[model samples]
Target chain A: MNSTPNEQVPLADNSIIDLQEVSIFYSGKIAVDKVSFPIAKNKITSIIGPSGCGKSTLLRSLNRMNDFIPGVTVDGMVTYGGQNLHGSEVDPVEVRRCIGMVFQKPNPFPKSIYKNVAWGPGINGYKDSMDELVEQSLRQAALWEEVKDRLHESALSLSGGQQQRLCIARALAMAPDVLLMDEPCSALDPISTAHIEDLLFELKSRYTIVIVTHNMQQAARISDHTAFLETGKLIEFGVTDQIFTRPQNQRTEEYVTGRFG
Target chain B: MTTDTYQAVQASNINKRSTRWAEFLIQSGLGLCALVSIITTIAIIIILGKEGFSFFQHVSPAEFFLGTRWVPLLEPQSFGVLPLVWGTLLVTFGAAVIAIPIGLASAIYLSEYASDRVRSIVKPILELLAGIPTVVYGFFALTFITPLLKGIFPDIQVFNALSGAIVVGIMVLPMIATLSDNALSAVPQTLRQGAYALGATSYEVTTQVVVPAGLSGVMASFLLAISRAIGETMAVTLAAGATPNISLTFFESIQTMTAYIVQISLGDAPAGGIAYQTLFVVAGLLFVITLILNVLSQKILMRYQEVYD
Candidate 1:
């Protein structure tokens, strides 16, 4: 029996990533069933679902970050720039360089703010002026004005909201084509969440973004496209406005209106 | 309020009162258990201080700390402790050279590279090195290491500082590795994932992120291992010769403070004699050094600890 229905949204012409019948497994048990989607370039795409619905598992597979977990196996294909990410010739490290990620919790290295932003590019042998790169990335993340004077202080000294923005700046330093965020603002306060949401809107012009969020309102507000997942299956996918206000599936409708998860 | 509900509330209050008395008694019992160790420590300090004061009357502090000669048991006795202190430092420095790099490398491998099945099997075997008796290590140094060194360096003494340092280094290897491995492992997985997400290679993540994150704990482990090496008695007493001469050459025979204490304790130094009094003074100095090291380790751990949620 087909677990995923044939209700996929129309593929975008400038899709940066394509997941074709991708199914993820932990040990032998399935976590993400056969799901297919196209991540449009320079657009914000948010995956919204109830807890344990495989949104995070699906998001991690884009950059092959799931390879770090023991006993994890992926079936089918995830392609970026006509190259299969999980191919034998491909290096996961290089893949991650082109597809940066922010975690559910703010996890800056125990380093100065400047060092946190510079570490990624420095380790990859960036030969450019590190000072300029650090400034540019922090500016892009909207964190430069507050932290400019104290760039040498430890990242841990920052508040929880500032730390999350610092993590964003750290990821932006790599200049990845796509940025994947797993509930990046969940640990933050309301003001911080609003700050990040505004920042995401500005980022949409440069990098393709894939976010998994438990907050349905956040997905409705920031995302151009939304995918509703339930029990490891994609229930519906379309423009964010359509998915939230005029969802076709019963589960998506029920979930959006606060009827049931 | 209903009479029945009042009666139920009163009965529960009486029961809670009885349990509170039992809780107080249990807490006091636990406090007494903790106080026992503190009392014993204070008692030991008092005894050592009284005896050390008498020893200081016979020997001046300036001479004991600065004078080069040490001949307490022989005639025309000179109580200068420089040679013994120098010998102990030499052995400790040599042992650190042998152990630190190897122990830290094995710790990195265990914490970062080894699979679960491999780690489970190998970690206990590595730690088994610590469980072996120090006496056996002394014998191993005398019977095996000395002969091996002598063949390489024909001028090497049979009871040389080289053999003693090598054995002591081996004795402390498991401790440094185990403690360092635990510290490295305790670094949160999220930090490692954060590094990897930045396209860091495994080596880069382990060295730059994980190692630096666990640096405080790793440093504490190193300091504690050095303290253990300084206090090591049985192995050094048997392997390092009882010659109190200040020399930097590992091929020459030397005597550490621990070895000196063992020598005097076994020999017929009459009770209450000056030679007997030297024992307490030396032991008191050793106690102070170890205490300082332990306190420094604790301070480093507390001051630099990383908090993760």
Candidate 2:
């Protein structure tokens, strides 16, 4: 019974996965309503909106993190490469293996830095070169150079920025096809945010990126495409520059101009 | 206002405030009470230490520690401590064996697995167990547990270490669980969340992260429970027999240090006699043992600490 996602957005090619009229209900309360969108493959697609707009909910649904919460029911079909992700035959754990997530706050286990990166690969039964894989994952997350000397230290002993990068390394160790970032830099200072932005830019050439950001400026800065949502509804989706500078929808323009949230 | 004017006004306010002696008197009263407790403690130590030193004069320390035979009430009155000491240790260790696993698991269940609704209901019931009288537990052990064990092990003695240890175990189960549960729950939720995010299941998170993080406090609480079991008198006196022997068999009846005290007290020993002095000696031993354990636990807590940011 809530407002719907924006309708005039260009759908992702059939080459990528698509959502059709996806609705999420948590304990009889609507979280995301009839939201339909295609997550572009191999591009930095940023979901930019104010807080409590179901942006994180939509991101979590992509990886089925919502499954952890009780009393959450979904009504819609999410097809990844034409395979029904929500179907009974598909395990949510497998879906998560394919689609990795990085949360707003960095959560590193109370383990060594090496173990933190090695966890995902070990769980997935990567039988060889676990040390190399840990190093490689840290390198991929652009954290290896700083942490290579202290791989035995607890991951939590790192600075906030370092810990966030370690979390990215942990997720990257999973080697997922797609990465979902929920407000990755919302908790970071500018220099750290810049480091992550540069890392994401480097990553997008190989991995599909879907980032949720409260910072509209961050959306305009690093993203290729931007989708604006408000009050559990998508208001606009377009090229990042167009969404920020010359928005087609009135609500998008208002949000972009800081006139309304 | 200028800086000088501000200081003047603040100074006036401070001077205007009441200089009542009532606050000082109340504070001094509390300080006096604390001092009383300290002095009473010192007095107890002096009294016990004097008698314990007297025991050293009658019997060498080596004989007390190493000698096996304990015939303190016999004609020669052998004052060897090995039997009583072994009996005390056996009962304490046996009690710990019963207490550690069951108590730790209950703590984990209460802190981690149980919901608020379950906790609110279960904790009060567990607390009720703690309120049960030790003598009642002694009676239950003698009547109920002894028969149960005898049914299983047909050759087992009616009043045995097994019975006493089991009863003492049940008696302190509530304290162990409650203290350990508090310690475990005191570990921050962030650590747990971090563990879960690493793909650790709930069980792994509990055993690996939560328990290790709270180990020091848990150890302190464990030591405290051990001391409680050692200090327990009535239960072991009734359930475990008065026969003091340095034996390892669970089938034989054994007496504990506290039990020996009770046994001696029940006899008619005139004041100022060596027997009367012996009472202080036993109590002094018990007090020192508990104090050392408490201090050791505190030291352990200080050493192996877990700090969360």
Instruction: Please give the distance, in angstroms, between residue A71's alpha carbon in candidate 2 and its true position after superposition.
Output: 4.7
Q: Say which candidate scores most in TM-score.
A: 1
In model 2, state the lDDT of residue B164. Answer: 92
Each candidate structure's TM-score, on Cα atoms with residue i matched to residue i, is: 0.95, 0.86
Q: What lDDT tens digits, residue by residue, belong to model 2 across residues B1-309?
A: 999999998887875466678988999999999999899999988988888888777778787768787677666776666788788888888899999899999999999899888999989998999998899999999999999999999999878999999999998888889988988998877566544544555686788778987887788879988989999999998998888898788778988889989988887566666666667777877888998998988887665454553
Across the candidates, what are chain A's individual TM-scores?
0.95, 0.93
Superpose all Cα atoms of candidate 2 onto the true structure and report the RMSD in Å to 1 decimal: 5.0
The lDDT of each candidate is: 0.91, 0.82
- Model 2 scores a TM of 0.86
List the candidate 1 regions with Cα displacement exceeding 4 Å: A1-10, B1-32, B306-309
Cα deviation of A239, candidate 1, in Å? 1.3
Write model 1 residue lDDT over A102-128, tens digit each, in one string: 999999999999999999999999998
